[model samples]
Target: MSTCGGEGPEEREREWEDAAEAVAYDSSTWPPPVVAVCGPGNSGKSAFSRLLLNTLLGRYKKVAYLDTDVGQPEFTPPGFVSLHVLEEQTKDLTMLYLRPPKRCFFFGDVGAHKNPKLLLSYIFGLYDYFLQELYCFNETDDPKKSAIPLVINTSGWVKGIGLHVLSEILRYVSPSIVIRLRTTSEGKNLPDGAFWLDVREGDSRVNIIEIRASQNSPRHLLVKKEARMIRDLRLVAYFRQCLPRDFSVFSYDDLVQGFAAIEPFQLPLSKIQVIDLHCQISDDAQHDFLAGTIVGLGSSKCVSLSTECPFPWCIGLGFIKAVNIPGNFILLITPASRRLLANVDIIFRSCIVAPTCLLQLQVSDEVDDITDRLRDL
Candidate 1:
């Protein structure tokens, strides 16, 4: 084994451009090119995927993105595996803006180490949906003109069970191209060649592109504190939808205050069922446990709550401000419109939680005055 000198940012950028161009121009893949970007944590998988997406958009009218990184998803919030059809190019690669996915499934947790099977099921479902709805059945002499190419942005978990999950995804999707970003830290990089395939598989046709990961990348080191802050910021941004477009929130503290003052929607408890995906809660303790927690608002055909119930279609997420057991109603805050809310028949609670700052209220005098006025009303 030999080691080489580190490459500069320019060289890395060039390599990324070359890889993206290759995927965009590759004519061999029949059902439009399906590209998968995979690597260990903080290895620039998301950055490369975005570049590939932008590059592909230059040639194809529309490209489908399958985001499997529930911890830090590209389009939707954490705890979801989603597919988005992007017709327009991403204006700024640095901006972390949220977009509604064409289809999504909330897995209720950030990492798949606990429930890899469930995560894989959701991912497979999304890929199948993309094939059926977007890619397959669109026949034309010029495949590029009709068929939408898919770019799969995978999770950073590359060792142990994470690796197993990645292998399953590769086997199932069998993408035309697999780009693995390599880091100088050999321990942090995935195994060479088709790491997902077993020795018996023998000479897979998947075009493998290996590029040295950029050291200049800000996320090169997976710092827990930084990662947690980023997740919290993303959550804040998501919930900020509850505010009016003209409303200004200049800082995190301001956002917290805004959330504290925002009026929440009240829903009759009888109309909706609640299920805890992570664990079971006693009937008496359900309300207390749910208060101030973030939950998935889903539409389900089943009226009763049961572990056996099939996963529902997640309409959006809501923050359970209060669970008024006495009133037989719940106060929730969400960005989902009333039209979408009307179909929400179930609430799924997962490991995802509202940041502590958002929950702790330092009531301002204005808020107190408003409360008194409301009470008088």
Candidate 2:
């Protein structure tokens, strides 16, 4: 079906109303804003996602970027959503593609926007989950109801229906940040609430920079010059759920040791090593690995993508060509994948893989210290 407006005006209005009525949380009790970014493919959702984290990290120690694009997840570990205090993101250093310091979580949703059946399913599933957990309409353990600042990177398949859906999504998305690409013609007219500084392809550099200059709030924002770096070896943990049925390769000793320290989605030790990729880094590998790899929560059978997955059990993801073992160059299996390719040179960039620990921010007293540090910036 074409992604265009459909049905009668009355029906359309009714559907919109139904959608609006569905999310009826009290304003005072509603969770923090969940920001989602949607634009045509190649509009640069990935790089901009980092911009969101980089800007917020100045204010927050921990932040999360969730990739709901499904087909093309941007924030995997390693080269993909690589946010480790690898280097400082400052005014002097900020460029088109600069590495960021600080540990922010990146998760990519497998069945994101392009897949309507899957997308709608998850949406309804989330709604049901929200009702069960928050509304208590049923007895269930649904965590989507939990309040967290969620940033959804959407898919780009332009059409009226997609735009309509995009608009509807915006209604639900109380964005603390939003980045949109203006065309060469409208580049000069880029409006408020959009974070992208770079103008569109057809846009002249003059207007683009002007639009960016308007967003000069980052000047006062604290930029960490020397940030701590972490590399999470636990990224292998995502393989359990994302990988396929009969595919795995792992060291018995390493598996045992890794699981001892951090469990890989409770994978049965017996089922380990089914998906073998020959190359295995030592457990005590020098740095945090999360920066350059995908980490999923429920799965532990991924091939390690260049970014991070949201669930923590990644099950599957892809990595750069250099990281792949011989023979299976363009590999895909457990820790299976969505093949969104990037330029090769960016792979060598530093990664942050250390596991993150959440400090309670709801408590004002303790959080005051962190806030004070930020205000000074």
Candidate 3:
């Protein structure tokens, strides 16, 4: 475990002043500036966001997709961003977050790692995350800021105060290109903008990423261990009017030098559609991320859930206990998701989503008695 092989002359002038503060692009050109693209969950960060938005706007430039990839945001292309449910009630059962509606759009739903803000006077409860970093570095309501490059699609649940609020929003609204994609199984890499450190356990910048702490890689290996686990990630430099999003925080091994270019990449079944949720899985690498298709939610049956795998704990790592929970609410299936819901009009296009809309009041009359006992059986 020996690194820092060579460097002096003030550590190569602080590594060329951290690579010119990582390509500062305070927006100037045309609608081509804010490039954010982060990584971690299922780590393909949306197939590197469709390979960097069809390789920088080739698929016709209106490119928006702002799900901000919050927690576990799925659905892509279909007119994007809609669901904004947030209900709370502990003991009597009622909890759901599905966020992302304002503070700069794209939030369809999901937010539950809860209590984790390093300090600086609780950054005033992140007033809706500093109101989307004040509309992503407001340069007159986003003149695309430093130039139409707004690429933020993060959320793979990082620690140390959300990686120092993503490095104080890249030093406050300064992004021209901070593309950091990471998906590792066992590969040694890092290059696309490098500072994703999360070192601990007798740390020593652990060579920037000895991160084999599996279940689906989470911590940094070293970009200077993000200033000591960002000291609990200091919520917001003791809060004072917030303003920050400059851009540049990476560590999917600093940008791919290993991890075999992110394995598990196979979704092209014409864009992969298989939602047969009669889940009672016995995963051999999760039979293609839980096959798909199946519905019923009055009393929401089908419960195996061994600790987790509801899909957004950032792609259910902890390897999901080899999955096969006999916990009840039965819905088990496998002959290929029962032949991909063997069509009952494609299982009536599937519907059973009560993780919380406050269960629309404990399941609106039990989902109309489970949709009239699933249409009289």
Residue 371 C-alpha lDDT in model 3: 44
Would you list the C-alpha lDDT of every candidate in the order shown? 0.79, 0.33, 0.29
lDDT of 1 by residue, 1-377 (tens): 11223378776788888888888986765667898998887788998899999999998889999999999898777888888989999999988979998877778888997778778877887777676567755466655436788999999889988889999999989987899888867888888888778799998988888876755344545666776777887888888888888889777787777887778777777887777766657766666787778888887742212232247557788888766555566778899999888788788887886787668744344335444555677
Error of 1 at 276 (Å): 1.8
Can you tell me which runs of candidate 3 are displaced by over 4 Å?
A: 1-32, 42-65, 68-149, 154-178, 181-352, 356-377
Global lDDT for candidate 3?
0.29
Ranking by TM-score: 1, 2, 3
**Residue-by-residue lDDT tens digits, candidate 3, 110-155:** 3322322211111222222333433343467554322223345555
Q: Work out the TM-score per prediction.
A: 0.88, 0.33, 0.24
Better candidate number, 2 or 3, judged by lDDT: 2
Off by over 4 Å in 2: 1-33, 77-114, 123-148, 174-177, 185-314, 317-377
| Clashes (N, CA, C under 3 Å) per candidate | 0, 73, 46
Better candidate number, 1 or 2, judged by lDDT: 1
* Residues 1-377, model 2: lDDT tens digits: 01113355454334333322222222432343344555554444544455555554444334444444434444333322222221233353233231221222222322223334334333333333333333332333554333434445665543454554454444443344344432233332234332232334333221111111112123222322211121132234333334344444465554433323221121222222222111234434412232223322223332223121211222224321112121112211123322312111111112223232211102233234434554677
**Which one wins by TM-score: 1 or 3?**
1
Residue 62, model 2, lDDT? 40
